[model samples]
Structures are given as C-alpha cells and as structure tokens.
Target: MTTVAAPTRRRGLFATLGDIYHERTNFNFIGRSRIWLGVSSLMVAISIGALLLIGLNLGIDFEGGTQWEFSVASGNPSSTQVREALKDTPARDARILTLSNGGVRVQSSELKTADRELVTQALSNYSKVDASAISIVSVGPTWGEQVSQKALIALLFFFILISVYLTFRFEWKMALASIIAVVHDIFITIGVYALTGFEVTPATVVAILTILGFSLYDTVVVFDKIKENQSTLGREKGDSYSSMVNRSMNQVLMRSLNTSFIALLPVISLLVVGSGILGAVTLRDFSLALFVGLLVGAYSSIFVATPILVILKEREPRFRALRDRSGPSVSAVAVESVVLDEENVMPAATPNPNDQRVTPRARQSRRGKRR
Candidate 1:
C-alpha cells in the first residue's frame, strides 16, 4: 500500500501583510474583551482617585485673578525678573509666566487701585519701560463661575445630542456604548490634567470638547461598519455576532490608526515646536489636551466601543440564537491535498445547513423576485 500525502500550502509573502493591514486580521478582540475592559477599569479608577484627591489646577482665567502683561525690549526676561518686579508690591508672590513674544504675564489676587498702580510702576521701572506700557486686566469670581457654568452647559448639550442621534441612527445599544466610551475618554483626560497639574484654561475646555467630537466620529465609523457587516457578511459567512464585530473592527482598524496618526502630527508640532521651542504657553495647554484626547479617542473607538457593542448586541434574541447555533462553516474548515507535505489537518465540526437562522438579504431578495 502506498502512503498518501495530506494537503498543506505555504502562505505567500504578502499574505501576512494583507491579513494585518487589509482587514483580514483574526485578532480575537471580542474574545479577549475582558482584558481590555479590565485595563480600562483600572485607568478609570486611577483617574477617579486623582480627581478626588489631587484635583485640577485651574488657571487664572478660571480662578479669577488680575493679569499684568508687558514686553521687555532689551534683555531676556525670565520668571525671576518678573518675580523681582512684583517683589515690593502687594501682588508679590504672583504666578509668573513667559509669553511667546518675549513678554511677561503676572497673575495674582485682585489688588486695590492704589496697589495696581504701584505694581504697574514697579514692573515698568524694572523693565525700563514707561508706566503706560504695562497693561492690567482684572477678573472677578463671578466671571469664572459663569465660564464654568457655560462649559457645563455645553457638555450637557453635547451628550444629549449624541445620545439622541445615535439612538435614532443605529440603536439604543450603540448610543449607550458610544456615550460610555466618551465618558471614559473624558475621565481619563481630566485625570491626566489633575495628575500632571497642568493648568486648566479656557483653551483646555475647548480642546476637551473637540476631542469628544473626534471620539464620537471614530466610534460612529466603527459602528457603521459593524452594522454593514452584520447585514451582509455576517449573514453570508454564518459568523456569530462577536466574530462579525471582530471582523468589522479589523477592517477599519488601519483606517482609524492612520487617521489618528496623521491628526497627531500637527498637534505634536504644536506641542513640540510651537510650544516647547517657541515658548507659546497657550499652545502647550491646547495641544496637550488634543494629543491625549486623540489617542484615547482612537483607542476607545477600537477596543472600548466595539467590545461594548458586541456585549450589548449578543444579548439580543437574534444574535443569541445565532451564537448558540454556531459551528464552523464548511468554507472555514476547507482542506486541500498537497504532494509535498503529509499532514493530517483536523477540521472543526461542520455547521448543519438546516440550523442556520440568518438568510442573506441578497438571497431573500432573489427569492422574492422569483415569487
């Protein structure tokens, strides 16, 4: 009797690349959701702890203080010079900052008119400038409170709009998942601000809102893909809901990463070149928030949002029935015969055709056309 060879084939050089970069990846994301959720839980917990303990470092705009700005033409003005300039005045011990245009910004508690004039003269004399050259602005606590209130209102309005839109556009489950992911990004970003002690300015508030939009956009894209795949590919392939979601995620993973990476380049330039090298303090506040938010937004769109959707959708009666009746399709367990390799490849249990619950929409349409 002659021994027969079992079928085996070598993967092409581009196969792995195609699998990873072209949405053919089989990364078990839905299967390993517990790990992702666990990691996110830890991050959220730490963020909550930081918020409760350390708290955010609000900027002068938020805290309500007097601001003095003046430029120096001759020498390189340091924070030390600004401190010394205020040393003799009631505004001494103020927070000193270097502006992008070689100016100094000093912020301190509200000062009396006489004290303000005295401080102006001190800064003018220290910098060898006229008293008229120094400019002062004062903010009351009421203004800061108003800003806080407006920011809160904007955030609330944003949440409401997102919830309503997602609920109608897809389903309540998708809306819930998107909202949870946004909330996750917000807590993490705020926690980072608190932990790093970065001053929370109005620009920071704007950046936070911008990131929420970015996060939502990414999540909606993924959700849309999942919805498309569920109706078409999932029905044709007899894939369970979780498997279908995983496929959809892999398909869009590269696009999400590329979009995020391209977006980060400009924000990174603002952070490093504009802020660090050019010494624009405001750019640092804005770019840092954008950078962190973009990264978290991308991650939540993939790992957080998709997994949560799978969990929610799998509980539906239709998806649950599909999952319970699941077995490897004949196409998934294809076997081939090869002359070079003698290996026995054990295929998975084949699915019974009668047990398949989902009929492809195309097939249904064809049947209706025939009828």
Candidate 2:
C-alpha cells in the first residue's frame, strides 16, 4: 500500500562532466555502433557524391598558371589596387596575393609572350619597380600532372608502410580499421574543400598528410589500451571483447579529448588569426585543411575506427562466443561495473554461481548439474 519514487537520472553538461571527472561514465559506445557507423556512411556517401559531381577546386599550382611576384618600392598596395592595375591588361582576372614579406604575387592562366611582357610592365609601374625586378614563372599542365603523380606515389608508400607496421604491431584488423578511418577523414576533408571551393594547393596536401599521422596516433593509443585490457582484465574476468573495447575507450576518452584540444588550438589560430586576420593566402590553404582534417580525424579515430575494429573482432569465434554468453543484461552490468570499479564508490563485484540475478535458464542448468 506504499508508493516510492524512482531515482531520477542525471542529464546535461554538468552531470556529464561530473561523471567524467569521477570516472563513472559508462557510455555504451560499442552497443550503439550502428548509429555511429550510419552517420559515417552518410558523410562518406555525401563526400563521394560531391567528389563525383562538383570535384575539387584545384589551385594554380595544380592546374598550372603564370605567376608574377614583385615588391612595392613606394607604398604597400592592397589586392584591390593590384587588381585595378591589371584591369587594362590581359591578366585582368588574375588572382592577387599579399605576401607576409610586403610583396604581392599574381597568378593567372598562361599568357602569351607579349601579354606577359605587358603584365610585367603594368606590375612594375604600379609597384614603382623596374620591369626586370618583377619575376615571372610559367607552369604547364604536364608539370602539374607530375606533381600530382608524385604526391599520389608518396601517399601510396605511406599507406603501405602503415599497413605493414600496424600488422606487426597489433593485427591486420586494427590496421584495416585504422586505414579505413584515415580514408574517411580524408574524404570528409576533401569534400569540405570541394563544397567550399577552397584551392587544393601543395600546402593543403602537406596538412592532410600531417593530420593523417595524428589520427593514426590517436587510433594506436586506443588500440594499445584495448589490447592491454583484453589480455589482462578481459581474460581474467571473462569479459566480451567489445565490452573490453568499450572500457578501454572510456579510459582513454579524456586523454583523446585533451590531445585533440591541444592540437586544434594552434591550427585554429593559424586559420583565424594567421589567414583570416592577417590575410595570408598560403596560411589559409594550409590551416584550413589542417583544421578540417584534425576535427574529422579525431572523430574517425573514436567513432569510426574503434567501431569497425569491434565489428571485425566480433566475427572471430572466440569473441563471438563471449558475446553470445554475456547476453545483453550481463554486458550492460559488466559495463556499469567497470565504472564502479574506477570510481571506487562501490564494493568490487565478485561472481556468485548461485546469485539470484542469474537468468532462469542458467539456474536450471546449475540445478541439473547438481542432480
């Protein structure tokens, strides 16, 4: 004849923060693998669609062009001034850049010999420099193709090396998952660039490679922890592989966040301050790629890589058997117990063969064994 109120669950940022601080977070990352994987699939599909339809905005460096560099001897002229100076010439639609060293660089489609001379004269007069002082370089499409080929070769070599190293270090499954995550990061980053029409320069390529390394580092850290826990805690306690992976993820979640935060700060600074405020075109190209790549890299390492690893691992007979034996409730309780163990707010759980919480089927089996 008595009614009791159920305890309310914590919600919102502060509660989540408290849970994280107290190491009482029991996030079911592995259990919700479908959601994470579905989101990634959507992103990848959109990225591929964009690539097929819109394509990347290849810069003058990749597309080949005529470039002119000159420093003003009189006064600093803004990009508008440089543009106006070229208005009467054949290079009217040229891309003008303000260099950090108080110089201006102009790029346009390859011009004829007479047109090039005329443009040089125009830039020289605008900057009050001798015609000879203005430097001009022309790149052809062949050169751009060569650059593309070299970059692709380097990327392929990097992938091969990573696959071999990771196979030796962990297993082929981890390597495959990590590589897939890295590719996911790349596609997303490239899709952003294509959608935004950002120029794909050499600097962007360099930043993409750098972020891939950072993504790999994060994935390796997580995989190492999972391996450690699987061999020690998981084996001793007979926990499922996915459960061990989930625990390992919770353990390293904070560390991953801190690393990503630190990595993003300088990149954001470079993008916002260096490029946006200071108007450095090269920095803009470099930092933009780094910013996008780092964010997606962090995401793929956590959501994409580990989930894929769990899926691949659960296919193995040993892990599949463990998953089958644990069942849903046992797995849930096991994850909660991990939180309790870390928080130390509750007594350590010990297995009891006759525990009432055991399923009726398990109890029946025990009774049959006793008979």
Predictions in order: lDDT = 0.83, 0.85
Report how far off residue 71 is in candidate 2 (Å). Answer: 8.6
lDDT winner: 2
True-structure RMSD, every candidate: 14.1, 10.2
lDDT string for model 2 (312-331, tens) is 98899988888887666333
Model 2 alpha-carbon miss at residue 345, Å? 16
lDDT of 2 at 368: 47
Misplaced by over 4 Å in model 1 are: 1-18, 72-81, 84-88, 99-102, 232-238, 327-371
User: What stretches of model 2 exceed 4 Å from their correct place?
Assistant: 2-4, 7-12, 69-106, 121-135, 233-238, 329-371
Global lDDT for candidate 1? 0.83
Candidate 2, residue 58: Cα displacement in angstroms equals 1.8
Tens-digit lDDT track of model 1 for 6-49: 55565554665565576555556676678889999899999999
Question: What is the Å distance of residue 364 in model 1 from its true position?
Answer: 66
How close is every model to the real structure, measured as TM-score? 0.78, 0.78
